[model samples]
Target: MTKLLNVAGAISLLLGFIVSSNAVAVDEQPQSLSQLQSLGNNNQNISNSSLQQGTFNKTNRSGVLLPGEASAQELLPAAEEGLPPPFGANLFAGGYESERSDGLNDDYVVAPGDKVSVWLWGAVNQSEVLTVDNQSNLFITNVGPINVANVKASQLNQVVTERIKQVYKSSVSIYVNLLTATPVSVYITGSVIRPGQYAGVASDSVLYYLKRAGGIDSERGSYRSVKVLRNNEVIKEIDLYDFVLGGYLPRFNFKDGDVILVERQQATILVTGSVRNPFRFELDKDESIGTDLIKIARPYAKVSHVGVVGDRADGPFSIYVPFAEFAQFQLKDGDRVFFNDDIRAQIFDIQVAGSYLGPSYFAVKKDTRLYDLLAHIEVDPNLADFQSVYIQRKSVAQKQKELIDQSLERLERSVFTAPASSDGEASIRLQEGQMILQFTERARKIVPLGKVVIAENGKIANVLLEQGDIVHIPAKSDLVQVGGEVMMPQALVYNENATVEDYIAWAGGYSERANYEQIMVINPNGMVRLNATGALKPGDQILVLPKVDAKIMQNVKDITQIIYQIAVAANAIK
Candidate 1:
């Protein structure tokens, strides 16, 4: 008994949760149904960052992949044996929601054959559902026929109250309500697909008759302004924009002789990109704002930013407007609007390759500089050739190669036609070929860093880095060279175990004129070291200094400049 009671309790809880989750209070029948379906669609597609509310759909960000990028279609897993389709149906204009609103209207006037609830109090106590006769009047048990066909809903209460007063002689109070409006014969005409009379409930919404008469002619009809006329008098107007902005619709009850007029769409505005209908909307002259364009376009809800293209006195130009500012802007004739979405990226990925001692392949915000990257990345002060550092981009290398190929073609053409003695022609050709080959090799060769550089005037130059870009730090070189006032100027194989004194010893030891304190070390990466004692890598350069009292600062500066150039040339050659 206890187990059965627990199972029943769990089932009840589950049922309650489902009902409560879908509950929403709405005034109208059609609006409530549409809102509920829209809510469910929104809840499923929404980002976890925001709530699922409002009539507009939740922003689905996964639709933004560019061309050539990988997609889910190519990598879909095997499907299950049986599975249901995804939730929500494809929405389009004149879909289920529009057709539903076309049903009977609750506020329709009491027409012939309609049912009305009548109750009397005070003098005579009675309650009955009276029927209206074919003559557009209602007949009570004791009272005769009372006309009510042409009256508006607002005046129905007064009209019925006065009729009851005449019968009861002011002694009884009357309570009357139109239970159901009779079937109405309405004529739908002008700029519609099927323009004819349709038999429908008198209380049905205008959308009902519009559908029965076939939907409005999208090519010629104006969705912005639709009208309902009665006895040659305009009774109501419809704007599709109202529903798009939230849930706003006209309240007009249909009558037997009512005529629906779908006015001709006059002005045409072109809408494209990320919208349901990339078609040109034909609207009235009064509808000239950005909000008006959104109503007709039915773009994705996430496309909050819009761009309007128009011709100006200076030529053609475009302006970007956000969703919040749509109402503040107006459109002109021959204008084209584009609804666009914001890119979800604000940073770029870059790499520090080669000999840099830092994390490789990280991201930085846009407008980042090589200098900024260098500051963040670590370079060995003893081995790094800082002066020869360059930034490289794959795209820049491709463009450079194209230019080099073009120049080579032109050079080959000029070289073959050069005037030369017939006997020496082969020699000339060989020499020029060698020269061209060397130039071509240099051009074809792309450095790890693609010659991108920030200015030396500022640590952070104005170089904008892109994704997959490389910042290379060249490797340490071999064969440390010893020069200056050494007894025997010589170069020795660089060894990690070799010290400054040891290299000098291999050069027959330092000369009497050598300055021990001014011993200099030049790395292949262009790093100039003074009085360095660290063990050297391959190709490291060591120069024993000469004794110089003649402006020691100036002499040291000159040596630094000369050694820096040599290091740069060595790295460039490779």
Candidate 2:
């Protein structure tokens, strides 16, 4: 008997441990059958007595047996008092303790048509199934339809005990069980990787539902404006960008039946133009700056005079700068850099060749003419071929045609003959890169030929010749030579019209050592000599013989006699 009692006690303790473990698992107070039955109130009422009796029978068989002398009825109460609350309540009221110690509010109560399961300790033979009706009440054996909804489980236990005390001799404990819960769900959509509805979502947080729906689509979604809708109304918008990067997730929590919507990303700026590579860059990060864009534009760009045409929200603005300056300047999106070649108009070069005074490259104004180029050269009057003068232009036929057309236009408009206007004449303006070659007709000859004539008083001599005309200079033997302390030495033609003074001038005039008194012209034909007044021509030689100091007086006398005789002859003629 002792061993049997020990075994029975061990079994009881094990059951107790199981019950305690179950009770500890309850997050909230155990709900009563009234709450569960109310969920299915329209259904048939379930009996609790049978369930309780079954529980009582099971406990009785597993424990110590009472004495044969002791009544089973008395033993039952003793047993009930010794057992947990469920057995005592079941013995009197066919129920268990409705009150629970777990922390939970009782404001949300189980209503009609609720299904509930009941468990009673030491009442294995009685019914433990129950449900609430549509009237928000549960019917018990001793206690009638008791209002359980909106009543705390702990409070309901006392109410059940009081009602059962009227029929039972001892106090009874009761337990309530709820088997159904309120339905709840939430919707997550818009820019989310997976947008859908989530059922059984708790009222605690929106993030739980969002996570279950999959996080925001970072590539195409905007974290800055995540909208939360409740009852079809936008209640709040959360910035997920801040939370994700800042490690602050608590700021965005969801409630039951809440809808979370991630918006799509907005439009961003695009950069192109004088850059190594042109592309569209996203403004997703905070590091996008104007200077950063310039770094990308450095290649494939002429840094000098980079032009930026900005298309902005307001109006368009244009900026130009050297490529270097542009790199130093901050750049922005939507700005286009246009690189163009600089066009200039100014002086240009032309080449001159052939028998020109100075054949070389010359710089002329953009609108210079062929005449302007020739004016610089010193043309030899006897050598230049004026009638054959021509300008050799170096250019393609097309260019030459264009030039001809322009020249004709100028001629027809009389622009060349027009007086200079304030703005300057068009014909005077030479086109850039034009070559002007001026030719001379006299330049083709190999020898020089011309006629020299002396004027009265021997003041000057003039040479007249046509373009390309050559004057034959007779060899030294075919000419007259005059020298002797003269101003200039001369070799003159014998038939030329030159006086003694003209010869003197040709010989660079007389020197201080010359004996001017004895000036004589020698003819190769004989020993006869002539005076200075005698006209000399081609093939004649004039010799101004020099005298020594000893013959000075004789020479002076002879000169005096000649002067007197010439004066007498001039007077007789008059």
Candidate 3:
């Protein structure tokens, strides 16, 4: 009852404050679709109003809103420095593709069962929807029979126009449109989940059939390449990577008797860089592999050294091979061979500092991204400022320095360009020049690298990196935040001697329902700790977990055991 009364009081106080301040405007529906989306749009109207009121505080009058209850602008906007999306939402939102195919190499051939409309205006003034016969012949009034078999779809109008012109002396306009594609029964064989004939349209996407057949036979299938054959001749090859990365399907419409064969991804290796023909090839056990690779990937004559990165059971290992022995050198599965003709090209280096243990500097290859480097660096979750990992590039710093220089030069010009003045005015101009020079010097001292803001979803942000980029990973700060079931969740100033108990006291301690023993602390690196020694740091967040009264929770005993363990360890550390 006491806890309920306290919460009620806080609510009443917040309401009274808002009513007194008149910070809120008239309630109306959001003006646009963008307002409905949680895309971090600025909510500055209320904040600006608060500032105008001379002084406004949130502690004694904390006005918050539940979702669907009110807008963040009207209530609690995402605190400016917003939190991450609930999880996996932003990461996988992009690269999501539909199973429908919308591309084709051919302009759509008029096949049997295809519905086409041919309109003969002017001389004849007639329109008819004609289904192409099995023999690819279209019967027309007055024009008789016209053979359209194996004819390009784009040429259908020209072909029909000529035929229609024959029936009339006056020039007549003809329009031909393919309404729908003919359905095809394609045979999917070899290394497929369910190899058999699948019924689909000629324009149907390959994924549709694969999905219907329960996907590929994982153990025996090839993920890199699949062949689409028309009359035993390879018409087109489909690479799954295209669909995965770009959501684009191959432009090959299946015919009635088309065959899709999935070859096994065996003895696969990649040859890239200076090689003329860089591709992934599957080899047969009896075939001479090295000779085939040499014939396919024609390396330049000047390429003396080739870097062969081999993947083995122990770990990944690479070695340099001579150009002479490149053909004869034995290759294995999962081997990546890179050929570089220029032996002494300039190298690119980047520094990834803070929250990392290894050498801060790394000599990376071209087109490396922020996430690519982040994958290699290991930061303690409890200490990392994940939302704001930033990149500082040398080029940006140079641009900023140039701008400062230009501004200082402009100020110097202003003094010279000024109308002729008295000696006292001249003395004031000299002082102003000195001030501009000092300001310029200060601006130059400001580092540009750390200023590039990195959002929580950097990958989705599509932040690119250039040469001499410095990726900054921050450690936990000095002000610790107390949240969860605290009477007043807030950030407290940290002292070297302060513990979690001291920080909780600063937050008005835990609420009546808070589980004191089951306290959860998220360290500076975003790591969760149970029964942590509450040696609070600037960025550490202490959460007083809520008690679950569910008797059906099977892990209740285990959780209690873990909580007790944490309590003991934390006290011992203290």
Evaluated with TM-score, which candidate comes out highest? 1
Reference-based lDDT, residue 486, model 3: 75
Task: For residues 134-165, write the lDDT of model 3, one tens digit per residue.
Answer: 88888887777777887667787778678767
Q: Sort by lDDT, best first.
A: 1, 3, 2
Query: How far off is model 1, as Cα RMSD?
Result: 26.5
- Ten-residue region with minimum lDDT total, candidate 2: 16-25
Compared with the true structure, model 1 gives a TM-score of 0.40
Q: Is candidate 1 or candidate 2 better by TM-score?
A: 1
**Which residue segments of model 2 deviate by more than 4 Å?**
1-170, 174-185, 203-205, 235-258, 265-574
Steric clash count of candidate 1: 13
User: TM-scores of all models?
Assistant: 0.40, 0.22, 0.36
Model 2 residue 412 lDDT score: 30
Number of the top lDDT candidate: 1
Candidate 1's C-alpha lDDT? 0.57
Worst window of 10 by summed lDDT in candidate 1? 15-24
Candidate 3 at 200: error in angstroms? 1.6
Task: Name the weakest run of 10 consecutive residues (lDDT summed) in model 3.
Answer: 15-24
RMSD of 3: 28.8
Sort by TM-score, top down from the best: 1, 3, 2
